[model samples]
Target chain A: MALSFKPIKPLLHTGTNASSRWFSYIGLGIGVLLLLCSVQMFINIQQLLKEGSIRKDGFDFVSITKNITNETMGQPEKNLFHADEIDAVKKQPFIAGVSPLLANDFRVQLSAGNVLPFSTDMFLEALDNDFIDTLPPNFTWKEGDQHIPIILSSDFFEIYNIFAPGQGLPQLSKETAMGIPVQISCYGSNNTVTFSGRIVAFSDRVNSVLVPKNFLQWANKAFGNKERQDASRLFLKLKDVNDPQLVRYLDAQHYVINRDKTLLGRNKIVLQGIFSGLGIFGLLVVILALMLFSFYLQLVIARSRQNLELLLTLGYSPQWLGKNVSKQFVPVYIFIVLAALLCTQIMQWAFHHFVMFDRPELSSLVNWMVVLLAAALVLMAVVTNARLVKKLLHGLG
Target chain B: MKLEIKNLLPTYFEEERKSTSEIWGKERSFSNGDLVNIVAPSGTGKTSLVHFLYKMRESYTGSISYDGKPLKQFSREAIAALRKDQVSIILQDMRLFEAQTILENLEIKRQLSPYHPQERIIEMARQLGVDHRLNALAQNCSYGEQQRAVIIRALLQPFDVLLMDEPFSHLDNANAKKATALILEEAARRKALVIFAELEKADHFPATHLYHL
Candidate 1:
């Protein structure tokens, strides 16, 4: 048997069907609600994670370090450490590795007596030869060959051309701990420096330069130290990123993880647990209200379908009747999705502005979930409407 | 138009009344293009007779054979074709849709016959003087217009029998004569059976057969 096409029924006009109008309103409403819920969930989860991060890692111990005030490096005061001082610390149990450094800040004159200040603050840091055991590998310096060999920073080339205002030529302040001390004044006409450092290492960071302990002693002698420590500061290494030992180590080292301003201050485990209870209550309220609204709108749409019965009576089959009814649901579902998505955004804004003291960034996951939920509801509503239309048809027949 | 009804009976069922005998009758014969006047007031089961004759529907007992085969032997699609193409009806209440325009209402009638195009609709409207009110909505149209529109729609198809239930109840004397003449003319032209629940306004027929229920 072969199937033949039936004559086409005239298309319903745009905005003509009353049923479509009802479905559109309902679908739009449902969509907006879902979108809003998703956004809320996103913001809530993000806030939870942010607060959690503060609670977990907000208290790291930092040992007070000082010694090599050698200014060859911009912050040579921060470089030198004492291994003997580290041994005196009660946090010796948590010790990882101790590294000491020497630094200098001075000017160097190139060929032709054109003396210029070397603005580069070079640092000579010495590791325990096992700094890798404590810090990650990518952060450690690997250099080959000693004298005449240098590890220049990425900004080393750039710093050479920098000019100081109101100064015609660069000048050097020769700091001497033991080596030859000579003061040089640069006249801009004859001062030109050449780049001769080996590119053993480079970093995008321009703050500090690195060298071995052997060179550090030379630099310390060249630039002179304000004060030298008895031993290096301790750099404790833990098996995991988070360890309770960090808190005790900070106490023994007289270090502190100040949290009165950061996220850690506001978060107490008990307080968050209470907030979670409130959030759950809020969720239940939303579901009940939204589901009721959805069911109400559905019934209203069902009543409008009674007017379409004459078509069915006039030889239109049930299946075609469903298609006719589906037109009503399409616009409604579209409206619902859009409205719900929009509502979610509004709610998220409101949550940040009014509800939460700390405005957490919205979660992408929650946003998408809201979208997905609203879409699913719209689809379900359409199918429900069609089924209702069918039941009505059977009743009329 | 030809039909065959064999041992037909109709019943109305209700929870309170249980079941009541409606039309306990049977028919077996072949009549072609006969102008029939089934003169039963309302609810004398004239619709039941026609319904059973065209095809035995729900709550109706006995099989109606169309052109010699048992109606039960026919598939749903086949019965649908018989109703849509072979047999057409003008419902008693006019059944004009409230949602459609006057032109649309008639167009639905025209659509019953796939072979007849829109040109035939213009022709039918012209003959019935409904061309002037082509754009008016259906419910807004006068009762007489609805009656004429329905009859014209039934005529649009090459129906074997045209079943009309008081299709001209609303037409006045002059328009009633015109509508009757037009309906009879089209029925005679096609040599189709025009079965109508006759009204006082129905024009006199010289040689037409009458069934006074």
Candidate 2:
């Protein structure tokens, strides 16, 4: 019987190749997943920031005032911010725009129908209409309009609900509160004028009762006060309150931030820092995994060096042998990328459905960015593996 | 084809402290069908001579050529071609992969050129008394069995020259005779030159010439 020549399998290196190749895929898969999720989370946070609704504490705006020491306390007028100080604050690189907090020059009394039935003293604050994020429709007023639109602070209702229950007064919802008409009496310089005020919206950004800037300006002039409006509070539009230079500038000016607003601003920076830290950690894991993979490749190639030399002596070209060595890793690279992409997609679905149930606009799974990340990982694996294999083969050859 | 060695000297042999031998600096030549026995003592350069001829060691001075052409002038591709098609070697260590079976070790050579039929390989293995251990790992075989396996593997390639370094060092008389017969059969079929190194005279192996190292 005629027998055929048999081709031999590499028995010496097969055991190691089978056992070690999966670890590279697992490590790379984890690294790719971590990096993809972090980048996805970053995109989600950025989207929330853009929508301006996720910020429970306002970060896009800052409130500043002159430092009130014991000495300045005695002279209340001296603690107020001046024009040049406001200009100087505006000159700071972080400041995008600056608006002074305008106050009504008169005292006011409000009475609801059979509700309060008594005149309660009230003060009014105003800001530019463009600054309020939740400005309701028809929130502005003209001189001929009798009903003045008001944006009540959420804090005011929190305080009212505390006491209104004990007083036997019916608790008011925001809609019911908006419908209840109130009579306002403004008394300043012995001249009294009454205006009808109705609640239009509630504000979370600004912490005081808000009237339209146009209404405030009209009321201040009509109430018989004609003076250079000196503002005691300043609302600052900041590009980024986290900027160190802005912090340093504020510190040097002996100016104080509104404690509530400052805390919110700092929280944003801390949150962003945490996200960035996660991104860096993911990158480090990838680098470490890559190094480990390279080490494994080197070891496998080295262990088989004798066999490889024998093969070369048997007339096998280095390129042919190197290609055979590298071919084993190609499947691993493909599997890693596919597994990572699948994992990221699963995570995205879970996050979108469970974590972000209310926010449907955000992505639920692996987006374009995750795909790009997978592509990048595949490229890195191929290029790095090719280079290492070539170098090892060259050394052997 | 003819192989020529002229004014050949290993680099370390030129140093004053070492023993100098005439064969280290001698000119030698080999042609087709010439079975040249290199008989020498223990410290002679028998293994080095085999290594140099296989192009594994390049630390020797002087010229080595094939026919009339300098071997140094051959490109890497050409040298690889020559190794596959013209020259074959049975190393002193056998160089058989210990992890592979006997037949698989033979296939390493057989598959490269696909020169020998499997029937011929099986017949050769039977003649050497290793056909039953063909599927056994080379490392598990006895020394004589492995030596015979190496001889069979070396003959699987087509060659104009066969370099055997202590090829039968571990073989008994009967198995050595069998291996010598197989080597001579292949050499005569190809009309090839066989240069073999041995400590003592191999009267069983017919040789046309002999050189003392």
Candidate 3:
């Protein structure tokens, strides 16, 4: 009787094509899941750092110190400080800028027909019109010789759309951006500007609505400093880059608190502990899964019935057959691990949608996780392989 | 091992359909180039003698040795080394790797064997009358083809002895003659011994060297 061998494929080194496809799917699913987690982790790290820097120096290279009185749910009214006393610190040379901001907690009835109840502590920067890169509130427009346009932050864009379908724009027509101005009834005077004002760019920091300095001053003066102080706080920026001298000058002020630096360190430790705990759990699950699903060498040896028979008759000892079979499966496992990692990295990139965490520390985490997964895969493959051999060769009389 | 079965004795417990039976046996040193034919009409322990010599059936009271050293005294690695270096077996059932080609099957054998000339395979192919199908997969080859390939593989080994069990069941008369000639030639070339279990007439092999059980 004729013995027919398996057919050859266009690709060399073929075996159990169905099994290979199953592994491919496993690798694909793993890759996509890992990618999702990786991107989220990366972006989370970036967010952490960005928030840290803002908390430290504040956006616009400025910090606010205000004396305020507000009603709190307390037995006795809490002692409140005055803004005029806070403005007195403007004489401090390190304090390069001072714009006392008077803001009140209020619910906003958005034009898109949604009510935003003020929840989180929201702060706004009272800016001068000439601050470069400052965008207008709630919109965007292209730049030109003289006209400065407004741009909306990503958060507002996702939440609101008018005239444009998706409402995302680096470039929008003059008509759409400049056709209708948003009316502000803040100081009860109900000031209105040309709804056709130009929009330039969006604020990269908090999802805050940006308006011109005139608009901010007008709103605040009409509403009164409410806190009853001449100035909210003195904002400061260093006169020169890497000027530690300015840092020293600021440090000399006893009121200077390293709140930013301290919080970053504390949060980093806390977050690290949490992620490490979760990562350990994940690693355990992966190990258990691999152990159960291992491509056992005994199975390979058992399946290699014809091969062993031929090798034995070919003057090879039972021992020799055992070793040769072990050698053969090495390449297969290596191929699987490598293919898995490659597909994983690709899926991660796809899931990220090209938005990677540019911060240094989080990127390092990405690198570490990739290496970690690769190592784990290899270890799992080898351990299961060796155990299977010992079992298969048991009682080889 | 000069395993002299001095005053050899054994015991067995055999449970039958409704009763049980036991038997005793004797053994001697398996000689070199002894075309050993172990025969018995029924259960007379013919195949058992070979099995005990190889220590494959170990529920016995006979001693096995290699170059005067006790088989049990050696480490597993040492025994494996001895098996590879000193003895080769053409197993009862023909077993081969399905993944390898016929040539690759032989090549694996040649690789495991000590240095042979580069043309050793071609020479063996020509002698076995399988030179035309060197690249065919061993699995794809017919039983006769696989049998010849296996015999050639055994011949390629630089070992002291060969164990055979009905190894020529698949060959035709002409091919069988060629294979027998090649075996005898390779045995003399390597100064090696061969033990074959014959299921046919012993008259085909040299009369002087044949031993019947």
The best candidate in terms of lDDT: 2
Instruction: Put down candidate 3 lDDT per residue, B46-148, tens digits, no spaces.
Output: 3454455444455656466656676557565565565556666665456666556877766666666544654887788888888887899877888988888
What is the Cα-based lDDT of residue A260 in candidate 3?
Answer: 56
Candidate 2, which segments miss by more than 4 Å at Cα? A1-9, A14-29, A53-269, A293-309, A385-397, B14-23, B29-35, B63-82, B127-129, B172-178, B188-193, B200-209
In angstroms, the error of model 1 at B59 is: 4.3
Give the CAPRI rating of model 2.
incorrect
Ranking by lDDT: 2, 1, 3
Tens digits of lDDT, candidate 1, A1-397: 1111122233333344545445546544643464356445544654554444422123322223433334534663344344555555534554443333333333333221223332332333333433322222333322332222233344543453244334454422212111222122222233422333333344332223444445444433444433344333343332221333444454454443343322332333334445455545544544454455345435543443444444444444445555565555467556656666676666666765667543445432335555676667667656766676555545543
Worst 10-residue lDDT window, candidate 1 chain A: A173-182
Cα lDDT, model 2, residue A113? 49
Candidate 2 lDDT over residue span A222-293, tens digit each = 774675366778887776555535665777888888555444345555666777788788778778777878
* lDDT (Cα, tens digit) per residue for candidate 3, span A1-397: 1111222111122244446435643643354344335434544554554444533234235443322225432412122225544554555554555444333222222231122111222233344433324444543223221222344455564444442444442333445534434322232334422222333455443244554545444434544433233333343442321223344444454334244533544455456556555555545544544543344333444555444443333334555444444445466556655665666555445544456444333332335556576666566656665556545654343
Error of 3 at B113 (Å): 0.4
Report per-candidate TM-score of chain A alone.
0.33, 0.58, 0.34
